[model samples]
Target: AGGISEALITTAAGLSVAIPSLMFYRFFRRRVDELVLNMEEESLKLVEVIHGEREPDRTSEAA
Candidate 1:
């Protein structure tokens, strides 16, 4: 067993599994956050454009 105990092997295996899992989760979370932010910005731009178009109509109605 190369003088390795069960506890040592388990610990090493756990570290190997947990490190990659944590990295993958963080990477995906960041990507998702960026995607959501981009979507929100696009939505806001669309709303602003729509509001701008309606502004002239409202001004004409008021006049």
Candidate 2:
């Protein structure tokens, strides 16, 4: 019985921090991945426009 309750309390406290820490880590990791993918797509589009492989969008010019 020695230190049984204390050990459990410590374990629970560790999980309280660890669970949310892991969740936030995954959340931000996914967010960063999405952003990087978007940036890559946008950069490809820009490269196409710069190299005359694709026509430039003219909506902003008309606006």
Candidate 3:
């Protein structure tokens, strides 16, 4: 009987720790994902501008 009670206490403690940890992990993961997505969008816009500037050089070369 004592062993069972001890086991139940340990299980409860584990769950208490695990639940908060999972919540924190998910919250941080969502934040990082948003940052990464924003960076990617900005990078794509920069690439498009650089590519647009190169068009004039290509036209001059053809002439």
Candidate 4:
């Protein structure tokens, strides 16, 4: 039979691991969302350039 100390230690260990794992998961999730938004914005700019709706940026041209 497990004693109170075992139960408490298990609970504490689980929480310690879980909290950081959850935080990292959320951080990466937000980063993925930001990357997707950036991709969409860049793609739209590409479409505009191809269609002659807008001029390509001078900075990009210089590069």
Model 3, 1-63: lDDT tens per residue?
A: 999999999999999999999999999999999999999976776687688842333433555
For candidate 1, what is the lDDT?
0.82
lDDT per model vs. reference: 0.82, 0.94, 0.84, 0.94
> Which pairs of residues collide in model 3?
none
TM-score of 3: 0.78
Candidate 1 lDDT tens digits, 1-63: 655788799899999999999999999999999999999976786687688843323432454
Whichever of 3 and 4 has more lDDT, that candidate is: 4
Question: In order, how many clashes per candidate?
Answer: 0, 0, 0, 0
Candidate 4 residue 54 C-alpha distance from true site, Å: 1.1
lDDT of 4 by residue, 1-63 (tens): 579889999999999999999999999999999999999999999999899999987786654
Model 1 ranges with Cα > 4 A deviation: 1-4, 53-63
Worst 10 residues of 1 by lDDT: 54-63
Candidate 2 off by > 4 Å: 59-63
| All models, RMSD in angstroms | 8.4, 2.1, 8.7, 1.9
Top TM-score prediction, candidate number: 2
lDDT of 4 at 32: 100
Better of 1 and 2 by lDDT: 2
